[model samples]
Target: MSIIQQMNSKLANMIAAGEVVDRPASVVKELVENSIDAKATNIMIEVIDMGMGSIIVTDNGMGMDFLDAHLAFDRHATSKIMDESDLGHIMTLGFRGEALAAIASVSKVTLKTRQENTEGIEVIYHGGIFVKDGTSTLNQGTVVEISDLFYNTPARFKYIKSDLAERQAIIDIFDRLALAHPNIRLTLVMDNKTIKSTYGTNDFYSLIDQIYGSKMTNGMTIFEQTVQKIHITGYLLSPQIARSRKKDISVFVNGRYIKNYKLVQAVIDGYHSFMMVGKYPIALIHLEIDPSLLDVNVHPQKYEVKFVNESILAYYIETYVKEALLKQTHQIPETLKNISKGLDETYIPLNLNFGEAVISESKPVYETQNTEKTPKLPDLEFVGIFSGTYILFQNEEGLYLMDQHAAAERIRYEHYFNSLAHPNPAVKHLLFPHHLQLTSDDISVISNHPKKMNAVGFYFNEQNDLVGLPIWLNDSEVEIAIEAMVSMIVEKDAIDLAILRDKLAKDISCKGAIKANKALSLSEINSIVKNLRACENPYTCPHGRPTLIKLSHHDIERMFKRVV
Candidate 1:
């Protein structure tokens, strides 16, 4: 084999670009992060052709001088840190310093910057080649324009999404940045249209209201705690406003947004009993700790961080969240605003043991049933109770048993399930508006699926961070029901009306049904029997558990040695 040689600088940069710059979104993240690291208070981002033709980011921060600009394109050159010691306590956003060089290697890049006190200068590079040296320009802030991205690397260009998808990715990055720093003003313009413009007023709550709506803002509960070198602060949704998805959970370390599953799971565990099975609560958490305890350089992109005391941190977060939820009462108020959108579109039916029986709006239809039309059973005989839950009966050729509670649950489950499938006219009016707390991440998830919620039998007003619940839930057990439903919604991305209805029915039955030891009157027993006989699966409940069991006379005789 021939001896191998070192790869060219341009080729090496292209490889680095593969790690830091995957799509238009990756480019946006790196550039925006640089702006943040420079302590930019005001940032404006513009994208053309969905970031395919060009992407521009302008920041009013501490810009670089001519020499700094030249060194900025060299790998491993960063103003944020010096050596390994600085790795433990990183406060700046862009530390790797490879972003600019990697990005320039695959695209046409023009970087123009001027220190607050120095004259502006510009440098242009095309496909890793320096075409134009430092030239006098006319600006105080830094303006980076990247054009024809992936030009040198044709293979990378093919993976770019459609214009709309790419545009959305840009918006997502912009939103995350804006959420992380509510004190900074941010502007995002796509194809000459402004999608978001925020004033740097330093009001985190108001900013949340603006982005997620007042409904969510109002429902949030402020969460603050300090434990053993870790200080946590953020907002959490009330139990009544729980979600089924983790999209609403946001975690930030120092000021950097991070994706830590352990931290997020800790938050979930904190709200465990407060929510129903399979539901998640919305949270926006910011953690402040000594940088020496964490490592942010684990990945090339730096979206994730590893903490030295990860287990301890998780325990603290979980305990904090749980205590906070328990200490507060999240009951729905009686004076909520009515914001029902109607049930015409949202409804699905689950096929169970019950059948739909229409009820007349006028007089009772059962009262006018013809006396002669009803047929009687020929020679049916009543038998004693078998198991405590079932009633036994006997006939000439068959023996039958029925479960009272199971029959009731099946009837209720089927009724609600079918109603959800084709929702009838719903009487909806909010009794009291509820404020939902959510993290910035949760807000992103909810914002993406407004139509899905509306398609279900429930409608909410996305104003003021407070979601207006359906009026039908007014008299119901408010907190538990809402939490359960939200949990279900989070588990299932879309709203399936039938599943929701069935869940609601199960919850209600579990809470309101008669217990096993309760005594029943003869009339009540007769009524239960009639209902059981009418049901399709009279021996089992909605949960698929057998409601009744029968032992024939022959089996009883064999046990007693009468038929041996």
Candidate 2:
């Protein structure tokens, strides 16, 4: 007998399905792409049980006929692409015909479509095998329903997350799609509740205001630039309105949301000097270029793209955004002054509570000549604590409120990170081992890097389908920590040991740290300050939010009209 043989058709299709149908979110993405390709003016997505039980997508577009509906579930049967040359200049959202076929192989699928000139038809397929085919009386549109997702593959089904998490993923996908197509009215319903519904408006600014709040809209500056064959148009938020996370930045290329790090970095670099450290500004950027210049088939999910002239594109993006920001600085509108002025309003002092003031002007003595011997730590005197969360402090320059938890998280992250750099570090042993059940793929990935985990104070034992977790973690939080760590490792193949260690440490720290409502003693406040001063990057936390913000005496005086 031959050692090697061709796999069966069913097995081959299941393997392909593994690549495309990763979760309910993946199914939603494929169906939405098909709706966009069909030139749908209005799209609606409804899900039950967070899309694990059922997903229904209805669109008002030029629907397919009976023959086309049957061929849609066949591999390599796409109306978008016919010849090999068509791949070079692809304009449609989905070209490869693997979506429906791959999705059908893993779940029970029902497709109903009707064209303007033909009667409606319905087809049902289960596990890539046809179950029922017949004409159906329906409205003048297309509706595709997918149920029992990943049912055939028990291993994949086991990895489905909580309903809340899956719903979040679906919302994220819908947000991206809505941002790209502002003119297409879209409605998303989950478990009989309307999550999002948008009117088909051509006004981009109105759409931005709806998605992001008024704060983002107030800081937004419109920009449009065209260089050679490429056109760029979008909104860039002012540096003053910055966020601590990258979730606010949205970028779309030719109506497709992508995660190109190089492009995002280029845009950030353009706003270099205007933004404060650890702050990221919001952006809604759209880029248009010749279809042949970009390739979107690089990733299985189509979230990443490869460009032919990346260098040139990067340059144009940087230059255009930089110029736009520079020009806006000179265009601040002046308030119109009344010629016939009434009596000048008297200044009234509002009873403002300036929390605990620890550092009074009389506290510590410092001699300039003694600076040569040993640099003294700044005399950060405590003011008053605010809302039991922020620690108000005063120094020679200004008043600052320090977020104790954020500061502690940063300190722990740096310490844990530095410990990982050493050859031998302390590893706290668990008194009782914790068992974690994971998918086979996750187990394979974890097994491949046992040494890396050992370096970061984690030990695991694989037996059957469960992995034994370290005893250091509490029994309740062990699952969450493991899941987070596993997700991080899978997303970033080569795990930076330091980053992993810090992430784990931060996760542990946040849970045990004092909450905002908790009252603190004077000693506790002092301890927070001491720990913050020890941190390498004391200004920002691990999540990149400013730990402390300063308001100088000079600024106070200016605000009070005491100084120019």
Candidate 3:
């Protein structure tokens, strides 16, 4: 016998099942795509036991006849593509013809489909073996039910995650499908409870509202630009509406959801200076390109794609997204305007709750230091402090809101960082000694770093108390701040000098800054403003919160409806 003999059809299908039907979500994806290819206007997905027990997908599309329904179970049987040339211009979501056969191999499947004006046909299969085929009365569409997924493959079943995890996977795929085809009315029901529903109005914004609520929808900015045959259109969420993960960023190419990290980075780059580190913006980017220039067959799941001129495409997306964000500043919605109008603009503190830092009568002991001259930001006329927390200013360019605490934190961080870098050997003794009790190990750790601590302005006494405290901290807060520093040092076995210095600077800056709800005079506000303007990066505090936000003149006019 030849060593390389052809495998049996059943064995061949089981191998294909390894790729096509990895999980319950994979089965859902294949069936729903088939329904979409059939031009389904409304589709419904129902699941039980997190789709491990059973999954049913029903669609109101042009269904198949008896012969076609029977043939559908056969491997490589497809109505999507006819010849080699047809592959270049493939538009339908499903073209491989392998989904149905692969899906049938590992699980029990019951399919009922009826063409318009034709009698419905029901077919049954258990582990790719034909069980029964007969006529049935049904609506004009297709219904596929899959049960006991991966039953034939115990190894795959053993690796499956918990029920909750599997359900999340299913939900993720459904979200992508809904985003890609916003015109299709889609509903998902898990364990008899409806979790999602879309009206199929062909309005993408409405779909966004349905999925992420009205707040996110209102914060979104629309972007559209065409470069050659590639058409890019989508919405970018404002920086304020950011998430910790990239899960909210949705990208589709030619109506198929895909994962392209480079494209994702391009989208992030679009936010540029507007976004803080480790935060991702919500994106719904759609790309329409000639099928020939794009390749979607690389991944088994087809969630990744390859296209020509990727760099150029990324640049185009980045450029337009930047433009859209710039325009967003000048286009505040009426709802936001109405709310802003009710508030007193001159002294609207806007709730600046920066942590537990207290306001003390003692002032910061420092001289205004010189700075290297850089490009100057436009000067603003002081309008006084809002809520005793924010510094309000206005000029020809726009209205500016500066977080009092953040500005001081930024200034203190830079001041301490520079002092540490140059090693200022100045220690001012306090009139009253500060005391903190700690474990022996913590006391030993602090003793070892006495010089290092003193360098950062904390001189320790023999009794684990501070001989002198940092000038920045209030008398009452010095013990807590010293304990925090001691705890930080204790947590690490050995600390890098640079890392230690940075940590010290950060702690001191946070504790020393002016707190929210603390009143400030005009001279104090001017001093902070002037010092902030002189810093290298005064946009955000050391902790990465924006120190100031500008409401442009154009935005003010737009808010008042002075011009359309």
Top TM-score model = 1
Compare the candidates by lDDT and give the number of the best one.
3
Predicted candidate 3: what Cα RMSD to the true structure? 16.4
Candidate 3, residues 1-564, lDDT tens digits: the string is 768989999999999888988888999999999999999999999999878889999999999988889899999899999987887777888888899999999999999999999989999999999999998878999999999988998998888776545766787788889888989999989889787778888787788766654545666799888997899997887665544457768889989998888888888888764553445677888999999998777866788778889999988888888788767865543323322332334332221122222122133322344445542446979887666557789998999988876778887776666555644545668676665533232454577678757766778778776788655444644543554455455444334457655665666576444222235666567667666666667888888999999999899899999976
- Summarize candidate 2's per-residue lDDT along 150-178 as a digit string, tens digits: 89999999998765457657877887888
TM-scores for the candidates: 0.67, 0.64, 0.64
lDDT of each: 0.67, 0.69, 0.74
Runs in model 2 lying further than 4 Å from the true structure: 330-354, 360-564
lDDT of 2: 0.69
Model 2 TM-score, all chains together: 0.64
Candidate 1's TM-score:
0.67
Q: Indicate the TM-score of model 3.
A: 0.64
Q: Candidate 1 lDDT, tens digit per residue, 319-434?
A: 88877755564442211100011112221111122222322223221243343554322233567665444556677645656555565665554445444555543635456655
- State the displacement of the C-alpha of residue 144, model 1, in Å, after optimal TM-score superposition: 1.2
